[model samples]
Target: MSPDTRIHRARVLALSLGGLMALAVAVYMTLGAVGSWSFVLSYRGEKLLTILLVAWAVPVSTVLFHVISRNQILTPSIMGFDALFMLIQTLAVFLIGAATVTQWPPVLVFLGELTAMVAFSTLLFRWLFGRIAQSLELLLLVGIIFGVLFRSVAGLLQRLIDPGEFLVLQDRLFASFSGADPQVLAMSAALVAAASLWAIWRLPAIDAMILGRDGALAVGVPHRRMTAEVFLIVTLLVAAATALVGPITFFGLLVANLAYRLLPGAPLRLTLPLAGLLGALLLVGAQVVLERVLGFTGTVGMVIEFLGGLLFILLLIERAR
Candidate 1:
C-alpha cells in the first residue's frame, strides 16, 4: 500500500483501540465496591468532567495557536498564559486571606477569572495585531517577556503576603483533577461548546488559514480578523481550563503531537476528533490506573505533566536530529 493509505489504516486502528480503552477506563472507574458506588461515581464524574474539559480545551486551543502562528512549537499557553493565570489566583488569595478565599464560592471565582483572561487577550491582541508589520516571533517574544513580568509580580506579592496566605497560594498552584468542581465544569462545557460551534461555522476559513498569513490574505481571506477571532476563542478555552483544573502545562503538546502521528494524514477534520478522543482516553485511563489499579490517591495532573514533559523533550530531540 502507499504511505498515505498505510497511515490512514493505522489511524483508524488507533482510534478504535483508543475508544475501547476509554470505555474500559470509564467502567473501571465506576466499578468500585469498597466505597459507596454512588459517592464514588459522583466524585469520579467530577474528575472525569475535569479531564474531559481540559482534554477538549487545551489540544484544540494549541492546535489553533499552531495553525495561526504557523509553528508547531507555539501554543496559547506559551504566551505567558500560565503565569497570568497564577498571578490572578495569587492576587485573589493575597487580597482576601486564605480562609475567606476558600470560603468564597468557586463559581464566582471562575467567572471572575474568565472575564479577566478574556479581557487580557482582547487588549493584547488588539494592540499587537493592530500593526500590519508585526511578526509572530516578535509577538511571542513579547508574550514571554510579559509572562516573566507577571511571574515576578506574583512572586513579590507572595513574599509580601501573610505566611498562611502564601501557603494557600502555593497549594492553589498544583494541578489537581480530583478537586474538580461541578459548577466550574458546567461553565467550561458551555464555553467550549460555544467555541466548537464557532469553529464549525468557520471550518472552511480555518482550512484556508493553514496556508500561512500571506497566502491566505492573497486569496482574499480576512487573515487578520480571522486570527484575532481565533486568538480570542483560544484564550477563552485556555482560561476556562486553567481556572477549573489548574495548569496542565504540557498536556496539549503530548496530545496534539500524538494526534499528528496517529491521525489519518493529519487532516484537521479527522485529526481534531481523533485527538480529542485520544486525549479523553489518555486522561480517563490514567486516572483509573492511578486511583483504582495502583490504589494511589495522587492527582492525575502530576502524572500527565511528567509524561507530557518527557514527550516534549523527545519532540525537541527529534526536531533537532
Candidate 2:
C-alpha cells in the first residue's frame, strides 16, 4: 500500500479506538446506576480516574521502553520494577509489622513506594546505560538478573514474616482497580502528566532512536543521552502505575502490540496516543465485562494476566519461528 494510504488507515483506526474507549467509559460510569446520581458518580468516578491514569501510564511506559530497548516483547515490568515494588512493600510490612503498615497514611505509603522506585531505577539505569557501553543485551540480562534477585529476597522475607503479615503483603502484591486510593490517584495523575509532557517534547528524538543506535548516531541523534532520558521517563511512568495498582506483567505487551497491529507503520506520535487509548479501552472494557458479565468473580488483573501470558507465549513462538 502507498504511504498516504497507510497513514490514512492508521488515522482511521486510531479514531475508532478512541471512540470505542469513550463508549467503554460511558458504559463503566452509567451502566448500572440505581443509587443517587451523585453517589454513583462520586464512587465510579474515582475508579474510572484510576483506570484512566493507569491506562495512560502503562502503554506509554511500554512503548517508550520498547523504543529504547528495541524489543517489542520487553516491558518495564520485565526490568524488575514490579518485583522491586513488591519487595519494598514486603520489606515495609516485614520491618514495621502489618498492623503498622496498614495504619500508615496512604499518601505516605504511596510516596515512599514512588520514591524508592525512582531511586532504584535511577541508580540501576545509570549503571546500565552509563557504564555498560549501551548494550541492549547487557541491559536485558542485568534486568532479568535483578528481577530474580528482587523476587528471591521478597520470597525469603515473606517466608520469615508472620503468616498474617504475609497474607497482607500478598494482597498488596497483585494489581487491584477497586482498592485504588484517592490520594495515590492524585499523585499518580501528576506524575503521569509530567512524564507525558517530557515524552511529547522528545518525540523527534524518539523517532530518530527508533532507527536504532547506530542509525540514530549517524543521523545526529545523541543516542546515549536520549536513551537515558527515555529510561528516566519510562521509570517514572511505570513506577507511578505500579504504585497505583501493583504490577501487571503482560498488560503492556497486550495493548502495545495491539496498537502496533491496529496502526501499522505509524509513527510514535500516532502509535503512542493510540496505544494509550487501547490500554484504557482494554482495561475499562475488561472491568465492565468482569462486573456486568462475570459478576466480578475475579479481579481484572487476573484476567489480564491470563490473556497476556497467552500473548507472551504466542509472541515467543512466533519469534522463534
Candidate 3:
C-alpha cells in the first residue's frame, strides 16, 4: 500500500477504536441501574476514571518501550516493577501487619508505595543506564534475576505470616479497579500529562531509535542519551500505574501488539493513541462483561493475563522458527 493509503487506514481504525470506547462507556454506566443515581454515578465514575488512567499509562509505557527495544513481545513488567511492588506490600504486612496497613488512610498507603517504586526505579535506572544504556540485553537480564530474587524473598516472608494475614494479602495478588484513590488519581493524572508531553517532544529521536543505536547516531540522534531518556519515561509511567492498580503483568502486551497489527507500518504518533484507545475499550468492555454479564466470575486482570500469555507464547514460537 502507498504511504498515503496507510495513513488513511490508520486514521480510520483509530476512529473505530474511539467509537467502540464510547459504546463501552455507555454500557458501563447504564447497564446496571439500581437505586440512587447520585450514589451510582459517584461510585462507578471513580472506577471508570481508574480504568482510563491505566488504559493510557500501560499502553503508552509499553509502546514507547518498544521504540527503544525494537521488539513487541517484551513488556515494562519485565523490569521487575510488579515483583518489587508485591515485595513492598508483603514486607509491610509481614512487619507492620495487614490490619494496621488497612486501617491507615488509603491515600497515604498509595503515596508511600508509589514513592518507593519511583525512587528505586530512579536509582536503578540511573545506575544501569549510566554503564549499559546501549545494552538492552544486560538491563533485561538483570531485571529477570532481580524479579526472581524479589519474588523468592516475598514468598518466603509470606509463608511465615499467619493465614489470616495471607488472606488479606490475596486482595493484591491480582490487579483491581475498585478502591480507586482520589488523591492518587489526581496525582497520577498530572504525572501522565507531563510524561506525555515529554514523550511527544522526543518522538524524532524515538523514531530514529527503530534504526538501532548506530543508525540513530548516524542520523544525528544521540542514541545513548535518548535510550536513557526513554527508559526513564517507561519507568515513571509503569511505576505510577502499577502502584495505582496493583501489578498488571500482560495487559500492555495484549493492547500493544494489537495496536501494531491494527496499524501496520504506522508511526508511533498514530500507533500509541490507537493502543490507548484499544486499552480503554478492552478494559471497560471486559469490566462490563465481568460484572453485568458474567456476575463477577473472574477478575479482569487474570483474564487479560491468560490471553496475553497465549499471545506471548505464540510470538515466541514465531520468533524461534
Candidate 4:
C-alpha cells in the first residue's frame, strides 16, 4: 500500500475505535440506572477511568516489551511479570502477615510493592529479554515456562502460609476489572501518563531499539540504556495494571498482537494509539454488553481472557505452520 493510503486507513480505524469506546462509556454510565444521577455517574465514572488507564498502559507496555524482546506473542504476564508480582506479594504477606500488612498505610504498601517490582524486574528481565530476542518460538516457550515456574513457586509459598491469609492473597492473585481504589488509580494514571509522554518524545530512539541490540547500538541509539528504560516502563505499567485489577493475563497479548496484525509494518506511533483504542474498546465494550445486555456483572475479565486466549492459540497455530 502507498503511504497516503496507509495513513488514511489508520485514521479511519482510530476513529472507529474511538467512537465505539465512547458508545461503551455512554452505555455503561446511563443504561438501566435507578439511583441519583450524581451517585450513578460518580460510581461508574471511576471504573471507566480505571479501564481507560489500563487500556493505555497495558498496550504501551506490551508493545515496548515486544520491541525489546522482539516477540509479539510474548506479553508481560506470559513472560512471568505477573507471576513475579505475585511472588513478591506472596513473600511479603508470608513475612509480615496479611493482617498486619492490611493495617499499614496504602501508599507505603503500594510504593514498597512498586519499588521491589522495578528493582527485581530491571535485573532479571534485562537478561531474560536479551536471551530471547532472536527466536520467536523460543521466546514464547521460555515465557510460558518461566510463567509456570514463577506461579508454581508462588503457589508453594501461598500454600505454606495460613489458610486465613490465603483469602487475602486470593484476591490479589486474580484479575478484577472493577473496584479500583481512587488513590491507587491516581498514582497509576500519573505514572502511565509520564511514561507515555516520554515514549512519544523518544519515539525515534524506541523505534531504533526495534532494530535489535547490536543494530541499535551501531546506529548510536545507546541500546543498553534504552533497553533498561524500556524495561522500567514496561514493569511500571504492568505492575500498576496488575495492582489495580489483579492480573489480566492475555489482555496485553491480545491488544498488542491485534494492533500489529492490523497494521503490519506500521510505526509504533501509528500502532500504539490503535492498540490503546482497541484495548479500551474491547474491555469497556465487553463491560457494557456483559452488564447491561447480559446482566452479568464482574465477569468482564473472564470474558476478555477467554477471547484473548483463543486469539493467542490461533496465532500460535497459524504462525507455526
Give stretches of model 1 more than 4 Å off: 1-11, 14-18
lDDT of 1: 0.79
Which numbered prediction scores highest in lDDT against the true structure? Answer: 2
lDDT scores for all predictions?
A: 0.79, 0.89, 0.87, 0.81
Output the better candidate (1/3) by lDDT.
Answer: 3
* Comparison by TM-score, 1 against 3, better one: 3
Candidate 3 TM-score, true structure as reference:
0.96
Residue-pair clashes per candidate, as listed?
0, 0, 0, 0
In model 1, what is the error at residue 59, expressed in angstroms?
0.9
**Per-candidate TM-score against the hidden true structure:** 0.90, 0.96, 0.96, 0.88
Model 4: per-residue lDDT, tens digit, 35-78? 79999999889989988988889988999889988877778776
Better of 2 and 4 by lDDT: 2
Candidate 2, clashing residue pairs?
Answer: none
Q: How does residue 198 of candidate 1 score in lDDT?
A: 86
- Across 1-321, the per-residue lDDT of candidate 2 in tens digits comes to 677887888788777887898899999999988869998989999999998889889988999999988889999888899999989998999999999988988888889889998998888777876786557678778888999999999999999999977888888988988767787888899999999999999999898999998899999999989988999999999999998989998999999999888777778988888888888989999999989889988888998899989999999999999
Error of 2 at 306 (Å): 0.9
lDDT of 2: 0.89
Q: What's the residue-level lDDT of 273 in candidate 1?
A: 73
Q: Worst ten-residue run, lDDT, model 4?
A: 131-140
